[model samples]
Target: MSNPNEVKSTLKPAYDHVIVGGGVAADKAARAIREEAPDASVLIISDVSDGPLYRPGLSKDLWLKADATLEGIDLGTTETGAELLLGTTVTALDPEAHAVTTSDGQQVGYGRLLLATGAAARHIDTPDDDRIVYYRNADDYRHLRSLVSEGIRVAIVGGGYIASEIAAGLAAAGADVSVHFPDSRLLEQMFPDSITSHLAEVYESKGISLNSGFFLSSIHAGRRLTLESRSGEKVEADVVVLGLGAVPNVQLAEEAGLEMEQGGVSVDETLATSAPDVYAAGDIATFSDPILGRRRVEHMANAERSGDAAGRTMAGTRTEYRYTPLFWSDLFDDGYEALGETRTNHRIEEVWNDAHDAAVLYYLDGDVVRGVLMWNTWGAVPKAREVMQASKEGRLKVSELAGQITPGG
Candidate 1:
């Protein structure tokens, strides 16, 4: 989609590599390139001018108080002394022409291009809706901070991390918060019913409404909106927020003629896109998970790990990106952690209580330790990880592994 002469005129002879997207993945890739290709020039381009900031940690500390600043958090300058292009959005990529253009009409040439565009919060396709806010970036956090003042009634739609974390923060701020989810349990796809119920109990204890198995049908704007559940129940809210998961930012890759699958850029173990001289990682790339034996997309911790690996690989050191999916969440005073993929068939076998602040759920698929759910048990994660690693390697059995890997007394 470019004029031949114009594309030809924009080619630059120098870059060791170029990274598009300014999120965690792009930062990781750039760092890896500098480490491996010490003499090569590297460049990073992104629409967000603030550079790189830790997003997952932001919801916990920064967004809770209205005074936190997000400036100077960018992933520091490139390691190879490469150029940084801030506040620039790449509008088009002409792979055939070996050039990419930004929305502001800046043409960039790259020897190898890494697309780690990441994802944005899913905004519901609603008509005449302006009251609903979805938090994704630093600006969104700041906006929510200002809107949430003190003792405000906040309604969070969707389940999982966003809804849970926002509810926790709002409750801590002395606001009446309601978290609505389409499922009866929190993180239904990842956590078991028992775990979700436990989280619900904790939230309820903190004066937060855990409205699971409910959906928002429509909204009205008058400083309050109406929410209808599938069971015909209704709710009124002061401010509404949606955390309906995320859709991968895949337009740039798709337009460049890179292959994609299951709404993500499909890649092998190496994190290379189907197109030549192109790569992808983070929430936008789907790859085979050796632990689960399936093609999957991990959004948080695993995504960063894989992104770092891809950056290293692009920098000239080749390594496979593989890790069991691990996650943790905090709700008020209670904290929950889980490792590996939970299987429905894995009935909880060994339930243990320790220090009255921790509980462990051991799941077994036949004789294998398929999954684990830990509450207030931050110390046991490492041992559980080891057991899961051994299980993935076909070397551990649930019955025999228990006594060997007992929770810290």
Candidate 2:
């Protein structure tokens, strides 16, 4: 714990470095900075009142299923010696003055600045209903928890990981659950049709309501909110949650005159912005994907990697962001994990169904394996990502790959 009086007295006008944002990227970068520069003064600025929290696991029902004791985030002990400014929201950046203004009117100066502000959840345009909730922070989870105590009904909107996880959580908690989706399948853009079908079947078997091809039009809050769907269907529910998508929080960068494209700050392999002595990372960063060779903004894995890389660079250590993007989601009794970039041209080399409880789907472009998706198979994630990074065509030989199976297979 830091003493407010002591911290305020020793505050430097321009610290050795200053980090913006409090998500995974900001935390990782701060830790890396401490590692490389033990003597340097580092300050982390974040809008989140509760420091940096692990976002990958922050679900809608975070209070119940997860560890409630771990309230927010504490970056262990700052061994490298970094200061944290919790509950601070950065309002503006002055490049010429090398200073950042906060919402509370505190001006922070720095030799080097890092932007890892992350992204914000995309909400739907529905009439405000006391029953309709948009899960974003701890308060949202608390609100949901209060509502769930009475064993009420829930209608989750969207089809992303958050939506799926929320639906699963609500269903598991004994709430009458219904998931509204724009398409006929879940995660239509990310996963193949086969995977989506499998997911739908699993959700259905769990007794969760799966309403596909439905777009929520409005919400009338009461004991049960009335939801009008585009399909002329009305869903009455005690609670409605939106997990549609996310947009990068790049307004600060844009206001600071940093080059932005596609609603995110543009960065190179080093995660450096156009402005000198400044860098950007996390969900708000748009960089050229090494595997796909296209510009993309990946929220989860990319944030940590980019933040660490930027931190090291700012600390005068050489680093580069080499990404083999990986993401995982848990739904019902099953978990799905994807490793590496799956090309459109890649053919399905091997599809092994491990009793449907677990499975691995490998994709190949000719003899070279490009990507792999595992269901309830986390042990293979590290190896799959490693193989993908090691070779352009990763883990290509299906027979050889299958031969090295363990007891589970």
Indicate the residue-level lDDT of 205 in model 2. Answer: 83
Q: How many times do residue backbones clash in model 1?
A: 1
Best candidate per TM-score, number? 1
Q: Give the Å shift of residue 196 in candidate 1.
A: 2.9
What are the per-residue Cα lDDT tens digits for candidate 2 across 1-409? 2322112334467788998887778778878888888777888876765556666545733533655433443344243456777667889999888899988787889999998887777876777665678876545665776788436788898987688887777776778888988877876655666667888898888777888889877777666688888667998887888887777788899988999877788888888888888899887877766664535555577777888899999999978787766777776666767765553346664455555456666676655566777766767766776555444545345555553322123
Residue pairs that clash (backbone atoms under 3 angstroms), model 1: 52-74
The TM-score measured for candidate 1 stands at: 0.85
How many residue pairs clash (N, CA or C atoms closer than 3 angstroms) in each of the candidate models, in the order given?
1, 1
**Model 1: runs farther than 4 Å from truth?**
1-14, 64-68, 72-74, 77-82, 127-130, 343-350, 354-356, 363-368, 379-382, 392-394
